[model samples]
Target: MYPRVILKETLYKKSQQKRRTSPCNYKERIFMLNTQDLTYFEHRPRKRPTQKGCIELSHIKCVEIVRSDAPIPCDYKYPFQIAHDSYYLYVFAPDNDCRLKWVRALKEATQCNNLFMKYHPNFWGEGKWRCCHQTDKLATGCSEYYPNGAKPLPPTPDPKCRFLDLEERIVVALRNFHPEEDTDLPLHKDEEYVVVDSSEPNWWTVRDKNGNVGSVPCIYVAEKISNDIEKFEWYNKDMTRTEAEELLMRENKDGGFMVRDSRHAGVYTVSIFTRASCIYRSDGEKYPLVKHYQIKETEGENIKYYLAEKYVFSSIPELIRYHQHNSAGLITRLRHCVSRNVQNSSRIKELSSEKWEIHPDELILSEELGSGQFGLVWKGYWHEQQVAVKTVREGFMSEEEFKEEAHIMMKLSHTKLVQLYGVVTQRSPMYLVFEFMENGCLTDFLRDKKGCLSQEVLQGMCLDVSEGMAYLESSNFIHRDLAARNCLVSNDHVVKISDFGMTRFVLDDQYTSSYGTKFPVRWSSPEVIRFGKYSSKSDVWSFGVFMWEVYSEGRVPYDNRSNSEVVEALNAKLRLLLRPRLCPQSVYDLMQWSWKEKPEDRPSFALLLHKLACLHQDP
Candidate 1:
């Protein structure tokens, strides 16, 4: 009351002090700013400190840091990041396409040394790093690291792959393809001057259009004739249709690599790496989770390289021999893939055991022909004719067992069957020679190049197998193993049923033995596995699984379960779920009919063939 009566100017001072001290009242006096202002402050470029020196700030992390800022074209790109010791290098491009172009440039410039140069403990390989670097430019002149081009130090060797070092092992975006060349090389063979069109030799007049002479040595004009064999090119494994076409166009425009042969016209070879797990099929669907693929590359008749996705073996013969004994050592097989210093046949021949010799005179052996449970296979020759020779370990199976296997194979002769050419059954080891199939096994062909084969192609495989089965049935033979890996393919789409090691001949259509080697129960009829008796009808049951294997791109049937569990489930009359959806309904219906537990209930192979033939005609 006394203060009110006094009503002094001190009261106004007190109120003003209170407003300044109160948080809510203080905030009311200032105008509010939006997040937009903060964003501007964050991205507004300020000069980097000068002391940083010659180092370009990577735009890779910058966009992420200032994400709210206005969009830049670089945000969509994949940055190349290389870390060496304490320093980290980053390269950001406008987009994936630009990134790929940059990568290509680096690859061309580095000469297979760019990846090693970019990483810590710099290292390189002769032709090893082609697929690893996105770009070929080396970071040079920096005192902090990689100073004076003193030849960057070699990488620490990986204990697993002794021949390849840490930085030397590279992961790249593209695969390389080099086809076999004919013995002859023409004048226009080089990339610069590929002959686009050539008419028949002008022998009409003594004086030609350019005043060519009549009597010249065969060598004088022979170079002008095109002699190179046609080639097929694979560019990038992950390429989209549009990207593939663009690459083709680029090849055409640049005129860097040209194929004069009509078969190789307008093509680019895509080199795939070892870890490459996906393949884009022509059907617009990408195949995912692939484990491996068998690859073959030949140059003239002198050199060949067997490439398993990324792993390259120096010679097919060595890989085959190694693959035979140790199936588990997949990567070890590639340790020998080194740069071609010279053409040495005697040295390679010396690498193998005295019992096994890889014929250097035959170029086909240079190419990686195929692989199997027994060992590495090669396209070889005997008596000057092409053949596939499978080399095995020294003490693999007893001679008696080898003879038994040979006897089983020698008796069979069917167009749909891979014929046994010869056998090297010496006391020291065992080897089998068979007719070479240019296209490789059906399992590999489908895995590498996937699609619904043409109706004609499908019919040919089906009919071929049917014909083979017909022979097996008439001879009272049972092909206990009838999967894709055991089947070979000819260039003409003909199928040959192979791998008859487990084959047995039955006196009748049933078995009385209480126990024997357990059948391939996954493919065997339920009655055969559960009841332990088999016949042609049991083979018909296996044919159903074979059909499923073909349709599903050789995916393991009932992939999640064990072979024993599959037998147990089938014995219990529980239906094994077909996982892949690509199988046709007709095939599914046929499998259900053939897989019935009662063997007698199954349809005949001839009947099944007729039904499958009908699907081909309609589908």
Candidate 2:
């Protein structure tokens, strides 16, 4: 039969390889839909196309959206599975719109096929089922078809519109809108609305599909393409399972392995070595070997992993790192050979260097700048220059911890970031010398210049911080404690991100806090507060709060609430009030963009800087 091409597009196909623990490796492919078959090529055509794979339309059993429970990359925005017989093919589209189009077209093309009664939600790629973690790769564990499986009938003519009505309508909920006057609509996250009017620049009048009509800030509605996959540069790279496992194993020696959890969707638990012993015996064995422990999910959304269950961590790596310091139990004493192997590794030596150490006499302490839990910051003289010296308390931080911080500080130097000069380790109280800011912290500066400073000045301050954060993001650094208090203002009103105390140098840009680590609750993102997970996106969340502080002239966020109260409010999805009069609508929109609940939904600092520059340029 002569084939009729129905649709064609550039899409990514999940490779059939299980080298690393990660689910699948996505490769760029050109997919084409035809009346007779669904085929894909290795690349775009020029002279002749090399066929990668194809499936006969008659063999197609089912096609449906991959649920959130599937073991797939968080960056894979539009995932779907196509099952034929017992096997499945997992594919990813660039956006939701593209994915929907493909799904609709495929359903129409294969309407007459004799399909299977059930379909697996996950793809059986390579030699195993990545989602179910089943070793029998060919086994069809379970399947269910979508209720709306049949091809859609032609649309009925609308009496109101002779022409096809194509005005864009979006379903979204208000994230941070508070009604001030009687006419303003009090918007909440639960209420969904359809945009009826968006002609006015930054404000839109929406009719709640459920029958309420009111005007709301355009930024309050969540964008439909929040997790657009094209935003990531590494979305097209393909890696084998072996490469992933090798990388994970090379990074650390603490026996890390990923396993799918049956109860949770899109969640996996990683097992790591723990120092604590298992006191409880299993299967008539007393004092059983407790070499490893699985990361456990705690109450609410918090996750912790430990053998003693006393210390909880947000991620597996955090738990492993913590045990390296507090190695007190039978496991540590027994695993001498393994510990020696890790210690002798070149990575550990490179991280423990003392090149940053400075002479005690080089720094002359003057007046104290500020004091905190770690120690004090002093306005000091170092090498004939004014410097801010941070002195570590005698009992607060360990030697290893200090070295880690110093090592990280030495590698980073940016104009918008407070530059670390050197460290004084010979003295009783160790000192970290940094570039001094004449105007002190941003909080006090903003509070002092309230009403006097123009909106352009405030916008300039945000741009400065965003530039610094973009640098940090590029360097794979996460400033967990990003806030107005942690930022310093130069004499010329340029803001520099300071207080690298909570900063982490991460490979994947994700850092999980160890148990009992104190984080500023008010400025923290939802993930940081709930799961103790810190990333550049979490820093973006804090940046939103910081922007709010700038616009409100440094007023305390959630001022009337206690730390516990703020946590409760955050859990209930309440956000800071919009400063309508003080801040421009455009600036408020940027702030709301940063506060998206899903970390991936938030804009990167690079994107944020661009948006701010565009807003500043606008008259």
Best by TM-score: 2
lDDT of 2 by residue, 1-619 (tens): 6888998988877655433212225666789999888999877456576799999878887776654322233244577767765556777887766777787788777767876565555555424554454668566555444434541222232344223225656645535466532224557674566666554323456666666666675545643323222232211123333443444345343322222222344333322333233345467654322232334556775444454566655444444444443332213411111221232211223232444566777788889888854799899897889999988886466545566577667666555788888887666577788899999989988888878988888888887888788878866679889889889998778799888766776645777764344699999989989977889999999999999998888899999999999999988888886563578988998889988889999999877876776666562
**lDDT (0-100) at residue 20 of candidate 2?**
25
What overall lDDT goes with each candidate model? 0.44, 0.65
In lDDT terms, how accurate is model 1? Answer: 0.44
Backbone clashes under 3 angstroms, per model: 16, 7
TM-score for all models, in order of appearance: 0.40, 0.47
- Candidate 2 residue runs with Cα over 4 Å from true position: 1-355
Worst 10 residues of 1 by lDDT: 6-15
How much is the lDDT of residue 316 in candidate 2?
43
State the TM-score for model 2: 0.47
